[model samples]
Target: MEVKIRNRSRVMQVLALAMFLSLVWAYAQLEWGVPHTVKRNVLQSRGSILASDGSVLARSVGGQRVYPQGVLAGQVVGMMGETDGLEGLEAAYNRSLQAGENLKLTIDPKTQAAAEAALAQGVKEHHGEYGSVVIIETLTGRVLAAASYPPFDPNNWRNYSAETRRNRPFLDTYEPGSTIKGLIVAAALNEGLTTPTTTYSTPMERYVGGRWGSTIHDAVPHPPTLTTKEILRYSSNVGMSHVVENFAADKERAYLSNYGFGQDVQIPVVATATGRLQRPSEWTDLVRVTSAFGQGMSSTTLQLAAAYNTLANDGLYVSPRLVEGTPAGERREVIRPESARTIRGLLQAVIAEGISNAAGLKGYALAGKTGTSQVAVNGKYSDSLFDSVFAGFFPADAPRVTIAVTVHGATTNYHGSMLAAPIYKKIAASVISNWAAAPQQLPKP
Candidate 1:
């Protein structure tokens, strides 16, 4: 009887062990499925993003999406999810990618790297809170590089904030400061209202629309009288006010809209910010005067680059291209070729002798404008905060590429010339080195 009882006890113990192992196996299966649920939803193989030269920017390997270039063009290329893309070109071309179609972007890998390095250095050296750089092929409107500073590694995107992941060139809008002066001047030139040599009796400070205490000031102390070219070179607000005197508010709005302001630009990516501009009906004298000098209006770096591209393309505004095989959009003659050339020359003078002299490259004609605008805080302009910008193209006589750089929240070297111009110079030189086989000699203006 004792032996039978012991045998029964042993059998019971073995059964209990088997039951526990079965439960353990079930728990393991459920836990494993939980983690793979996100990935299991994907039904197809994802595609990849490549540079114009076939360098991989982002790709899938062993069922894991990876950015081989790491942080290079992170915001521009964006990141992928288990099932689809999240931002930038990834999100824009999600459907095509999911269908196993390869995407070749217009982004030049070398130029993108150069832009990233230059911007990163600038942000660190200048102690800037943030910065952005954009370069576009003048004729093709192909985006060579769209780099935002303090770049985040898409490989570890969760570690970064939305601001760090933001595609600034396409999304972030700020008062373009003096950068818009060139466009305003271009508008004036296109209207035949003023010549580059046309002179204005510019004052250091003047009341807007003759409204007392509503004053606009120039950054540099200018002469009592200056020419239209001089106004651009000096980036004089008061001079711009006088230059736009012939322009009606409605006419200015038309010109602005024609230049692709206040409209979302559809690239291969989902970049949509037309930037904010007051309607024609909302334009008061103060608004008009401030808008003339790049205040009272806001634009993205991409918009600024496109506007500069107009000058580069000899007055034709081309939509920016991201994917290589994408069709070129309709090219509209917004400004006369002659007017665009004149403005280009005026901008060259800005680099050659004006506030943007720091941006000039040796043996190449650099044409760009510098903008320094006060940051608006809580609907009022801040006293100490500022955003600085430089926008221009290289080889002014025969343009190849257009570049725009903006540095935000600059506390100390806040002027565009002081902070942004150097960055522009670095990026321009790097891009020229990569794009041009033999650098063309530009004549001294």
Candidate 2:
């Protein structure tokens, strides 16, 4: 009887062991198998990103994300990671993209190509560390092109550095130098403080910020006296100081803020810099003078383009848009239409009569301003390094497109008029040709 009872107990122990083994196998399968299947299914179902013309910018195939137009608007389209987007628009709208929804962009492929080509040539020719070009449609604020040089190839993004992958138009910020002069001048016009023909005694150098403060100098030799129109044409730093000399600091900050400086531009891209604009309380005489000429302040290339677009759009500030189906950007009257028109006319004169004549197209009425700001190294401005910039709009009488260009750390030919202006011309010419833009009669200088 005792032997039979011991045998029954052994049988019971074996059955328990078998049950434990089966449970372990089921748990292992649950841990490894189901998630793998779901991941595979998710990747296979990932959606595509399309340009405005339905050309595929990014799409998933064979469980991999592919960029058809390699290095073409790559930074703007961005790249996907092992399981998600890593940067740019991909990252901006990752959730919808992962859910198998298509993201359509406002980027025009031909315009993007033209901008990239022009920017590449200019940056290479000038030996710049990097550069970016942003083209915004005047009326809609749709970004036609946003090109960054040393282009990032989404297909091979791992090979490039973060700097190369950076969308400089949105992410990078620099003191815009004299480009801000146009905005300041527009404010002066709005306030009835000055007119296009108003005159200021613009010496080559002046102590507008008081003798103990920094002395401002004009980039090029100009007359001791210059009209407000000529001040813009010459891009005279000293003249900018004089224009804003009587302009109060709080009011200046208000105008800049109204124009989108120091304010979030609310672009879809990640980490778009608002670009530093100090409080009015921080404004000293020297700071005010420097800010007038685009020092003591900084702005992204997109912000600069959009500000010029406000002038192009007849005083209406349209927030720049990248993704389609997104709500249209905030539109507000930043300045009086008359004041905006006056600014455009003055900028047109700059292209026609100033050093920016290189940007002029034979038949198209172009308007723009050039900026060359010394780069700050450590804590002080570096004499050797500079940021060359150009901001302009085409068919100035009735503008359709606004463009902003920047070449950073150029080794030679660093002036905005020398490098950025010509680049602007090349891009504008290509765009005009691509669109077969009608020729407008150039206004008399």
Candidate 3:
């Protein structure tokens, strides 16, 4: 009787164990969003972010990769879509920003903060339509801060249109305007077109063909017999027009290629445009002259940065980078060392003594160029709207970081000096003064 009872208990126990195992197996194989499969919800996921100094910029609230900076993060930090197509830095380095990996961006948050603060003020002052500011680490090609106005909050990316959410700094292209003149000066000198001492006489306009005409005038007009230094300072179209008309097209083309025009950025982000750099063979005389003054061509802001960065680096164009892993970009040799030096001085005048002279920082030596291109409308330059830009680097002797500041529409004035240069001054002052490295002496021109 006892043995029978024990056997019955053992049989019941075995049955219970079997049932439990079946239940566990069933739960393990439970379908998630699909029949008969187990799945986890993405709404339950999170991400992380850290600054260079080990500070948390943003992290998931529930301990995952999430938008912590809200809408303030620029195209470089990226966006989290409702359906999960990562935009900006989040998309570019999804694995790093989310997978609990440590990332050290080349940006200095302090500098970025200053830039943002200044730009915020600028937008308010100008009542501008759109704007962006980028500060770069010259040595590493790391984008410290890249932002455009009317920021689309990354948190509510779905609320904004794709166009507004798109990263304009690295994505959009425009006629770079007079900003390219600084670089043209550099290339001309490097290719042995003329020295800083070289000069040109100006006319109001020069005609290449009947309809294709190039004009030389300042924001208003200035001296006619302008030296290369003076041409850059005053931004003479005639002088630069002469440059394009006189220099070998192949050499100029090579310089522009080296300068980072007509090239796509390597930031691991999608939809980056390779700005148009029409070859010498394709050029008309008008195009050449206009291009000399940064018209008749288009370029992404990153491409513009690359051009200015080259001049800052003494004619060595290093690739502007934002991602980790293998760096496919390189330093292309564009100009002779002295030519680079001479142009650097003339550009220095832009910030130090030229048109943008008011953009200077008290103790630091800086050189840069201003661009105020007319916005295109119906395939013609718009009379009212303009893209104002200021591209430069500080401590002009040995530039460590280069920056590009732009405002699409300035209510007070359309020129870059009145708006862009002021912002550069504000950002540069804070960035250079706060750097940890001992303050270096200003480089001699």
Best by lDDT: 2
lDDT of 2 by residue, 1-445 (tens): 9999999999999999999999998899777665556666767788899999999999888777899999989998888876778898888888898889999999999999999999999999989999999999999999999999999999999999999989899989999988999999998899888888888988898776665597778878888999999999888888888888788888888889888988899765456889989888888888877887899898999999999999999999999998888888689998999999999999988998875457998778899999999999998999999999999998888899999999999999999999999999999999999988778666575
TM-score of each prediction: 0.90, 0.92, 0.84
| lDDT per residue as tens, model 3, 288-397 | 66778887778877778777877777777777665445364676777776777777777787666654345886556778888888988889888888888889987677
- Superposition TM-score, candidate 3 onto the true structure: 0.84
Q: Give the higher-lDDT candidate: 1 or 2.
A: 2
Give Cα-based local distance difference scores for all models. Answer: 0.85, 0.89, 0.71
By TM-score, rank the candidates, best first: 2, 1, 3
Best by TM-score: 2
TM-score, candidate number 2: 0.92
Q: After superposition, how far is residue 179 of candidate 3 from its true place, in Å?
A: 0.6
Q: Count the backbone clashes (under 3 Å) in each candidate.
A: 0, 0, 17
Predicted candidate 1 versus true structure: per-residue lDDT over 1-445, tens digit per residue? 9999999999999999999999998889777653464464352377788989898988877667888999988998888765678887888888998888889988888888888888888878777899888899999899999999889888998899989999888888999888888998998989988898988899898887765339777779778999999998888889988888878888888888778788677574466588988988888877777888888888899988998899889999999888888877667888999989899999999998874447987677889999998999999999988888989998888899999999898778878998888888998888778666475566667
After superposing candidate 1 on the true structure, give the runs of residues whose Cα lies further than 4 Å from its correct spot.
1-44, 211-213, 355-357, 436-442
Lowest lDDT block of 10, candidate 3: 32-41
Model 1 clash count equals: 0
Q: How far is candidate 2 from the true structure (C-alpha RMSD, Å)?
A: 2.8
